[model samples]
Target: MHPSRRAVLAGTGLLPLALPLLGQAVTPVRAEPAALLRRAIPSSGETLPAIGIGTSRRYEVAPTPEAIAPLREAVLRFVALGGSVIDTAPSYGTAEDVLGLILAEPGLREKLFLCSKVGTPGREAGLAEIERSFKRMNTAMIDLVAVHNLIDTAMNLATLRDLKAGKRIRYVGVTVWRDSQFADLEAVMRRETLDFVQVNYALDDRVAAQRILPLAAERGIAVMVNVPFGRDRLLKAVQGRDLPPWTAEFDCASWPQFFLKYVLAHPAVTCPIPGMAKVAYVEDNLGAARGRMPDAALRARMETYVDAL
Candidate 1:
């Protein structure tokens, strides 16, 4: 069974009353037209869909077999809808295992740009985590393995580089989710050779755009965006607001699309992974990937509209 909504909210530091009850079943609703946008990996030029899924609080808290059933279907729906990237980590409870079970099915493995992270503080621990991730993900080779939160960057990157050299992984990267780490993250971007970097950035949180984003572009490092909805905080911000008619000029059909489109508009963003347990939310999130993204003038209008709210 799924954890009580109260329990899940507590784990995520959100109040229980903010979300619907857990036992109340939610149905998966597919988007009318599956939308997809592609962005290239800086090093290999491999194109990944601009929208991806993240397994953090959503999958981490729902570790039981029955609780994960819908998640499997969601993953299948994600691929069916044209999404290619799946971002998870050893830290995210049984997320890797859940993904492994789904991907083990025929044709699903190749459909994913499988991505996971290593966050242990030492080289040995990091390597052990990598092995565990591979085992749990049921993949002999992962599309990307990132150093989570920049922990032991020097050591983990060295090991990941070795793994990449040995043909065990396709790309190696590093990530930072907190603002405090931007300095260290920028330093790593300047000094280290990496294929990608994942960071917390959203329309409401533009701090990363100041330096981290430009640095990534300048250094030819692909960027994966986390918390594009600001962990549901941004969702609450736009709750009852209708999509302004002008939002359609850039192809935004819903609030999630508006928020995601804002982030993907930046030339440097490779993908944005939004976490969702329900397939409906996944479909809604994927809609942002379709058609045209905001150009400079439209982006300015988007900023003004969001700021006025």
Candidate 2:
């Protein structure tokens, strides 16, 4: 049996709050249908859900029903709860294949703002990888395609632009997995007409905020934040700790929301894609988009609180 939301979080220093937004039986949380927050993609003015799912290590699983049932439920229920963005990549092993199968369910793909990546060097190789991604993800046109980790970025970005011009992809951008590579990412952001840039930013991992985020805002580019929990490092650090009483002011009910809300509260963040394959965890993460986001002062307090942990 899939664990209840509370069961999934039993020992992680947090009690799962009832999620009015999630109605799946796989997740025990219950409440009314509170809408997930929506923010505009600056380049196009199209809106997307403030919270999204990331298919990385969590989704590189066999496509058998026994292996896929939970991940499928998570994706389907995420859309039911109003999530629109789903980011995957060619490097994520069987993730795109599994996602293609799950999203094949009637009306699923249309409801999603599907994003994928390509990392090959030459234009022809990049095009081949993108075509493979399209086949793996079962889509004719991808909403966005980024150059993964800035691999052959100039060539890839040019390729992405050509694809965009031909209407093969809706948007073109780049991604930076590590904070140390911010200089290259920054240079590209300034030089290219990108629609998005995926970067890592949790309360503990604030390097992106120092410049990338603000620059994206300045340049009318959208920001998709990855590794919002410091790639699980923050979760490990907060284990067995108590939720501070003050978190209620902004309606944060769990650790995931607390971490996600911190990222969401930043004006420049278009979405925070936390890697979650469990329905219960998806329910918990979606709640971050429903409540009062912390103001700058509250955000400062949150940083200090988490920093001292």
Candidate 3:
């Protein structure tokens, strides 16, 4: 359920303590339990927490206990603080492995709306990779599985369909992070029966917004935004600039929140899976899901503001 105005109180005690983020303890955003925004999967109507964790560069750690300790803590805190979506892939080095170990932490796996991808081509290879993903993530079933970059889209998607039909997976999706693949992504969206589509959309990168997002909504496919910050290009673009005072009209607090809120405000977006490497960052990003979202007018202003920078 999406958080309501009655739920966005100053202190609902959502975050009780400061958490370690990159070894620096910082005040986590105080959120309301009822206000933590969630969006439904158009396929199964399963709602997901709006902010998701992305294990790309962050979770590719040395699988030793010491090196994996911080990541484990972050994942636990993320779930503790009302987060559920966790996206990982086999191509992301030891990310799947790290999550496998982290999943062993009692009661964590079931709490997550876990998502992984199958990047390899061919039927057998795709099936094998999906099987290995389950082994690597230490789960018998995953909530959602996507075709990484829409790779060999036909065969891989066919495999995902079989897995879903067998109840081995709950939902099937395809991902496209590059603008060049927009044609391919949209074609699949129009042709296939999909529960979700993971794509790159952000304050700076609005190209996907032009058509892809609308298509997802029209097709009834849930949308998960990847690289909402445009891979940090948006962050670096706004560095040292004070957030426009008018931003507070919608309850936007920080630049990161601004970036994320801009994406989430779109009627079509389900969640923006930003890569939060630390516990503090995760808390900060969740703030976007708590406050009043910017309206369409504010969204236009945001684009103008960023383009001027």
Candidate 4:
């Protein structure tokens, strides 16, 4: 049984609230459809759900029956809740193999917009890695392949471009998680005709908002936000705090939604992929996609509230 349905579940991940928007009382959101929120890929205008799931530390596990059961359940729940994108990397040990198992089952691949990365730094190594990715993912065509952290970026992007041209891959781009690497990331973004750019951005790490996000908007590149919870640091910071009552204005019902909605509220953010290890947590994370998003005013208020904390 999924823990979420075991009881009427609610969360307050140390969230803070200020005065209600225009003093409006919290209105209930009971009958909203299960539709997930979506944003457009600037390059092709194709829409993707604004929330995605990541498989990093959470997914690097041995291929035992006990280990895969919950991971499998979380994935199915993610899709059932209107999620489409699933991000992974070769560096995430055994994640690709595990994901291949899930994807090879019936209709799962068609339902997901999959993205993987080649973190190796040489031409042959990068090529070898992506080929392995193809076989491991059990897909002849990958949706997106990025040069992780821009290692040997030019070479990897070149390879991905060739693959894209051959229709072996649909999009090519790069990813970076550290602020120290943003300059190099921007340099590559400025020089390449990329389809996507993955970067870190959370309530705690808003550096991407200043340049990377705006540049993506200007370059017509889709943005995938990583580390939305500051790799769990933000969650730890807000531990035991109460959610603001006015969060309902933007349809935020829990702390996870508060963090995710903050990232999704940005126009340039296509999706924020938060990793989950449990079916119930996946359901909880997906809840962020169902409600109203914070507008500019509320976003400012949210930033201020988190900053104060």
Candidate 5:
């Protein structure tokens, strides 16, 4: 029961608003339907916005003033929309350097709940990379440090544990995106003492719901979802399709909202980090954070609807 384009246009009354006056900056209208929703991290009971930004390939840009301005705006606007967590890594080309320049703004740095990872193999290499992240991101103490893709899991987790003990980072965790890695990922979640785990989940990919997500809930590990859009595959699937009217029950206004609300409905999900490179995308994604989330039955309906597409 998707709304027709004309019906949506008529309901929103977008045709009546006048253009901005000259010399007056148009403030982006955000959906303040309610306060931005938050979920607690299981280990420390710290809470974060239900939706966060993932700067993977998106934030990797030439570290020039002009080149980095849009990214800077995205970061600033993300905070303005009540976002806190931002996930990045050294593996993304020039991403740390560009983000470093943006976060050099003292206000912006303080506003973010920053998380980065150690990707190299040995403890020495991991330590060197960790120090480099500290330098590149211009932060003395990071909010979280994870073993990217479970690389050198034991060695890197040991280093993260030491750093956490030393108070260089507030939390320690791990991340992986492939379903093939879920067994190994689940093993670590079971055997190790971790504070968080980032895995792939979206309306299009529900593999995490089977075991990884449930195990995280059982083990008291915070879950950060990556690939919430299925790397744009889901968007392409619904390209010309309108969102179902029942999505409004969860306060969803767009396909992205429909997708994100589905992921967040799982009690184990702390945040879903969808990579956004533009201010408009940030606004849309942040809007998803403010609205009501789907209930179990609604989530099942959403899954069935998407499966049919």
Candidate 6:
């Protein structure tokens, strides 16, 4: 793992959450279909589900057969619960392979709106990586392809534009998770005609809202949110703090829902991708996509609650 990725996971104290639990059949939670928000790609008007699955650490480390079984079930549960967008990358070791295996199951391929990233810094290398991703994903065409972290982003975006025009990829976008790259990301968002932009934004991490999100809304670019729980740091912050009762107003049944709904409520955010390996966690995360989202006034109260904590 990259040191930065390790640091991101370590900062969130995810090891405990990742501990293996006895596999139990997860009962699907009955959540009414929340109001679905739709956004159009600037170049193409294709609409996408507003909540996506981030399969970074979540799918990268299942070394044992026992460990992989639950993930297969989790993927099924995710689709059953109305999840369609799944984000993965070549850099996420073994995640693309594992997702490929699960997706090969009968009726699984057509159920997903797949998104993957090219981590290589050069145009040729990035295109080669995306080709490998196509083979690993067991799909002829992918739904979305992004330049991961904007490494050689301009070159990669140019390549993506060509591929998108040829119908090899449905949407083209870019992602930046680190705070240091915000300025560059803003420049790209302003100058590039993109289908989407993946960003790090959560209730506690509102910096993106100050600029990136607004630009995306103005540019008619769909937004895919990564690290919605602040890479799990926000979960740690709320560990001891009981969820406020007013959270129930939006049918937020857990802290995950509370945090996720806050991000999903943003009109600019088309989706919030949270990574999880467990079937129960998958069901829980999908619940955030259902039910009433906090309106502006209620969103303020949520921020205040988190701030007070």
C-alpha lDDT of candidate 5 relative to the true structure = 0.87
* lDDT digits (tens) for residues 88-177 of candidate 3: 999999999999999999888789989999999999998999999999888999989999998899999899998998988999999988
Q: Model 4 scores what on Cα lDDT?
A: 0.86
Tell me the TM-score of model 3. 0.89
Candidate 5 deviant stretches above 4 angstroms: 1-33
lDDT of 2 by residue, 1-309 (tens): 223334533535333465455574333444455688899999889999999999999999998899999999999889988998999999999999999999789989899999999999999999899999999988898999999999999999888988999998999889988999999999999988889999988999998988999999999999999999998988888777767878888977778788999999999999999998988888889988987999999999999998898
Off-target runs (Cα >4 Å) in candidate 3 are 1-34
The alpha-carbon lDDT assigned to residue 295 of candidate 6 equals: 96
Model 6 Cα lDDT, one tens digit per residue, 126-220: 88999999998788889899999988888999888888989988898999897778999999988888888999999888999998889998999
Q: Report the number of backbone clashes for model 4.
A: 1
Q: How many clashes show up per model?
A: 0, 1, 0, 1, 0, 1
Clashing pairs in 2: 20-31
Tell me which of candidates 1 and 4 scores higher on TM-score: 4
Model 4 RMSD, rounded to 1 decimal = 8.2
- Model 1 C-alpha RMSD to native: 10.4
Residue-level lDDT of model 5, residues 1-309, one tens digit each, is 554322443455433234679867565552233457899998988889888989899988899999999999988988987898999999988888888999998788888899999999998999999999999988888999999999999999999999999999999999999899999999999999999999999988899999999999999999999999998899899998878778778878788778887888888899999998998788777767765789999999998998998
Clashes of 6: 1
- Candidate 2 lDDT at 54 equals 96
Estimated TM-score per prediction? 0.87, 0.90, 0.89, 0.89, 0.90, 0.85
lDDT of each: 0.85, 0.89, 0.87, 0.86, 0.87, 0.81
